[model samples]
Target: MSSNQRKSFFDLSASGQKKRLKAAQDVPLPGSGSQSSSSRREEDVPDSPVPLSQPHPSSEDQALGHCPRSDELELCPSASSSDEYEIEDENNVEDSSEESSNDDDHDDDIGIREKLRNWASQYKITATALTALLHILTSHICFSSLPLDGRTLCRTPRNINTVEVEPGHYSHIGLKSTLIKLMSGVSHTINTVILHISTDGLPLFKSMPGELWPILGSIKNVCSLSKIVFPIGIYFGKKKPIDCCLFLKEFVEESIDVINNGITIEGRKFQVLIQGIICDTPARSYILGTKSHTGYSSCIRCKQEGIYDKGRMTFPSVNAPPRCHEDFLIQRDLDFQVSESLLVKIPGLDLVKNLPLDYMHAVCLGVVKKLLLTWTSGPVNKCKFPSRLVNQLYSFVLCHNLSAYCSILGFPNTI
Candidate 1:
C-alpha cells in the first residue's frame, strides 16, 4: 500500500502527496471549508500503553506519563526498599541494549545518595527534567539516540524557499514562531498538528551528529495556505484524495515570503524559522523545535566526514541542531518561549473524523485545568511557555507512543 494509504485526516492522507511533489513548487491546498469536511473518521482509539510504573486505562498520552511517574519515586532509593528493582514489564519499551542503558541511567539518577533534603525544591524543573528525559528516550527513537553518536550542528540548507512575514526578526521570535503566529488568523482553532522532519531516507534522530537531510513537512491545521508549512489545523471533512501529495509539493516550494524575509526585533535583524509546533491550550504552549531551516537535515560535518553507510563521530560541530537541549535533563519537551495557550481540539485515530469537539475541549481543560503553574510571561527568547506545559504536551505523544507507532508499522518511524 502507498504511504498515504492509511493517512489520517491531516494533510498526509492525500493519495498523491509524495509522488507529485518534486520540483519544490508550492504544495497545493484544500479550502478550509472543504478540507474540514474532509476530516478522517476515527476507526480506533486503542488503549495507549502506559509506561513503567504509570497508572493505566490511559489518558491523552500514556507514553509521556512515565516522565511524571518519576514523581512517585521515593526521595531516596536506598532509604529502605524491597522493590528497588521494580521494572514494570507493562511499560512496553523496546527490549534493546539501548533501553538497558536507559534503566541504568534512571537508577543512577535516583541514587545520587550524597542526599539533599531540598533537592526537589532547589531544582525548579525536576519534574520537567524527568519528563523530558524519559519521554525522549522511551517514547521517541527519533530523539533518544545521540545524534552522530555525538552532536553536530547543521547549517541552513541552500535555496529553501523563504518568506518574511515581518520587517525584522526578533531574537525570541525565531522563524518558526513568526510563521505560526502569522498563520494563526487562518484557523479559529487547531484540532491537530502533525510534525515530522524529512531526510533522504531513514533520517537520523535529532540527537545524531552531523546526520541530516533537508527536513520537510506538511502541517494540516484548520487553515490552508498554498503549501504545507507551519500552522496545521483540520476541520471536520473528507480531505480530497490528491491533497496529500499536492500539499507536499506546494509546501516544499512556497516559503512564507513575508515571514521569511526578516523580522527586526528591538532593532536587530534575524531570519525566521521554517518549522514549529502548536499544541497548547488556554494555559500554555508546547513549541516543538522545528524552526524553519532547522530540524532533521544533513550537516556539513556529515557530508565531509561520513562514511558511505556509517556516520562519523562529531559533536559540538553539528551545526543547526534542533533547538531543544539534548541532555537527558531537558529533552523531549515543547517549550513555547511565549505565553500560555489553549488546545481547542484533539482528534482520534483516523485523520478524517475528530474526537468530538466537546470531548477534546474537555480533555484539554481537564489536563491543563489549572493555569497556576504558567510562566511569568517573560520575553519569548526564554521560551517562557513553562516546562510544565511542555511536559504535558510531551505526555500526550509519549502516552500514545506504542499505539500510534504500532498503527503505522508499515511506515516504521526510523527516527
Candidate 2:
C-alpha cells in the first residue's frame, strides 16, 4: 500500500496499533543519510516565505518614478530592493471612460437603425408581393386603413371583482360598476350616449363542447366607421337562463340609475340610455324571457303558432302584435316568472323595438349560407339549380369581382 493510504498512529485502535507495529518490523527502514525520511518530513512541514520578484521597469518608467516606492517594498517584508518595478507608464494615450461610453452608445444606435432599416425593407417587399398576389387573385380587393389617435387608444381602468358564493368559486368583474365608470369617463364630450348590448354564444373549440357567452356593448353616438365594442361580461360553460339573469342583474340596476339620473363628467352631465340589444333568434329569445325560436309559439313579434311542417317549424302569415315596447312587458305564456329577464326590468329599453335582429346572423348565416350550400351540394329536391348551372353561376359571380359586396354580405370570396 502507498504511504498516503497507510493508517496513521491516531487512526489505529489499541489492537490495530500492535498489528501495525508487527507489520512495520517486516518492512525495511529508510537509511539515515537517505532523503526518503527527510522528504516525507518536509512534505508535512508548511512552506517557507519566498521573496517576490517583479518585472524590470522600463527606463522611461524608472525616470518617471512609476516603479514601486521604497516604502511599498518595506511594507511587504518578503520583497527585496532588487525586485523589478511592475508599475505601468501613466503617459500612454487613451480615450476618457466617458468618451468610450458615449462611443459605445453611438455605435449601438447605428446598429439599431441599420437593423430597423433592413426590417422595414423586408416588410415593404413582403407587403408589395402580398398586395400584387391578392390583386391578381381578386380584382376588387379593397384596402381600408384607419388612423388611431390618443383618444382612440385610451384604455379605461378595469374593476375586476370576485364574488364567492361557494368556497373557491369566484365571479368575474361586476358589470354595474364597470359600465358606470365607462359612461362617466365619456360623458364630457357626448351630451347623450346610447348603448347597444349584444350577446352571443361562442363555441371555444370546434371539436370540444366548451362554450362561452360574451356580452358586448357599443356606443351609438360614435360613427359607424369608428364604432368600437367593449366586452362587459363573459360566462363560461352552459348558458342557463338563471346564469343569464344573474349576469345582467347588476347591469340592469346600473342602467336604470344612468337613464334616470345622468352621469356628470368634467362638470358636464350626459344622459346615457341602453337603446337596444342586437342578437340572433336564440339569444334574443333568452334575453326577452320568451320561448325558444323552434318552440310551438316561438314568434317574438306575433302570437302566431308555428306549424311543424316538413321537419321544420314554419310560421304562417298572421296579424303581428303592435311594434311597441309595452307589448313585450306583458308576460306571455312561456315567459319565465321566477327569473325575469333584465330587458323587461330596464326602463326606456323597449324589448320589442330595441331588440333588432342581427342582419349578419339572420340574413347572411341563415339565408345566404343555406342558399349557397344548397346551390353547391344539397339534396336534389333542395338544390336551387342543376350542378352545371350552379357552377356557371359561381363562375359568373367570381368574374364580377364583387369582393366589397361579398364582404358587406359577411362572406368575402365565398363564391
Candidate 3:
C-alpha cells in the first residue's frame, strides 16, 4: 500500500484500537522476523546516558527552587512561598546597610584621631603633653607675671622704688632718677652719669634715596657690656641737614643744664657729664664739622696730608703735630674749618680726647680685611701686597698646621 493510505494509531481513542496498532507495530517485517523477542526488547530500549536535549535551569527558576527535569515540572515554588525569601533578602540588605553606616562612623572617629595626631606632631608635641599644655595655656593663673631670668631684672624690689619726673621741654624730667633706678641693683658703683652719644645713618628703603640720622645716647660706665643706645632724635631726608646743631639745639640746652646743675634721683643728687661721641668715619666727620675721610687733610690725629691715588685718598704715616682744641679755635676762621659746630662750643670737653678712633671701622674692617684680601687674592689693584708671593706665603702658613688658627681669623680653606 502507498504511504498516504496508511492509518495512524493516534486517530483512534479506544483501548482496543491502540492494542491493535501496538500489535501491528510489533509484528516484524519479513526480513527482520528472525531476531528473538528479548533481543528486540533490548534494541527498543534507549541507552542509559544523560539527556543532552534537556533545557537548562534558568537563574530565576533556580532562585524559586525549581529543578531542570522534564518529569519534575512541579518543583518550582509558588508565589506565596517566594514572598518569604524576598522579605528575608530585604532584611539582609538592611543589615548590610546598617553595618556600612557603623563602619563609616568608626572610620570618622579614626580620621578625627589621626587629624589630632598630625596637628600635635606638626608643632613637635606629644599627644599627652599637648593636652596638658593646652590646659595650662587656657588657665587663668597669670603665668606671664612670673619672674624669668632676663625679664625680672628691672622688676626687682630693689629697682621698684622709682621717682616719676614730669615732662620737660627737651626730655622727660627725672630721667636721671629712672636711669639710677635701673642701675640700683647692679654691682657697678656709679657716682655720676657719663653719657656717650652715638649717631649713624639708617637707610629707610633699599631702592629709595631717603635715610634717617638717629642720635643715640647711653651711659658710658655700663656701655661696654650692656651698650643700650636710646634714641634721642631722628632726622629724616635724602641728604643730611645743613645745620645739625640746630636740630640738636634742644638736646644741647638740656644737657648743658644737667651738666651744670646735678639731677636729683630718689632724693639723691647725681652729677651728669657729657663724656664723648662715638661714631663711624662718615658720621663722625659730619657731626664734628670736619673734612671727609677722603679729603686732603682728613687725618684727625695729626696734620698729615693725604695723597689722592687711583680712586682713593691715602694718608702716609708722617710725624706731624696733632690738632688740639686750641688749634681748632685758632683755625676756626680758616675756610676749611667749620667754626659753627656745637662740639667746639662745649666747655671742659677736648675734641681730640673726646673723639677716639672707632676700632671696628679703622682697625678691624679697614686694616684686618685689607690684610686678609691682600694675602688671599695677591693685591690685584691698590692693595698693600702687590706680589703673588704673599699668596704663596699664605699657602705655606696653611701647610704648616696653622689652618685652625687661620680659620679663626676668617681665612677659608679653599681660597
TM-score of each: 0.14, 0.53, 0.49
lDDT of 3 by residue, 1-415 (tens): 3544433332335675546434644666466667975565344422232343556666565444333332332234345537877999999999999999889877765664455456665676654565565455436453332223222212224333222121111222233444655566555556787888777777789997776666677877764425665666556667665566665565566666677887765566778877888889888877777788888877777877788998998876677777777767667424345545676665556777888889888887788887777765654555556457666776777677655454344444554
The window of 10 residues in a row where model 2 has the poorest summed lDDT is 143-152
True-vs-predicted CA distance for residue 107, candidate 3, Å: 51
Clashes of 3: 0
Selected candidate, larger TM-score, 2 vs 3: 2
Per-residue alpha-carbon lDDT of model 1 for 1-415, expressed as tens digits?
Answer: 3644432212333444332222112322334234331231111111122233433324333322212222342232332222333443334454666699889876654453212213433465354454444445445553343222111112224443432212211111132444455455453343333333222212345564332112234443434643554332211112111122222232332334323454443334444333332222211111112211122221211212222323432224455333322211233322222211111111111111211123234354443433422333445555357667756765765556556454433322211
Per-residue lDDT, model 2, residue 238, is 38
Cα error, residue 100 of model 2, in Å, equals: 25
Model 2, runs deviating above 4 Å: 1-160, 164-190, 205-209, 224-226, 238-241, 320-324, 332-339, 373-383, 386-389, 399-401, 408-415
By TM-score: ranked, best first: 2, 3, 1
- Collision pairs in model 3: none
CA lDDT, candidate 3, residue 354:
89
lDDT of 2 at 174: 41
What C-alpha lDDT, on a 0 to 100 scale, does residue 378 get in candidate 2?
Answer: 77
Question: 93-148, model 2: which lDDT tens digit per residue?
Answer: 23466678778877765664455345545566454454454344345322111112
Better-scoring candidate (lDDT), 2 or 3? 3
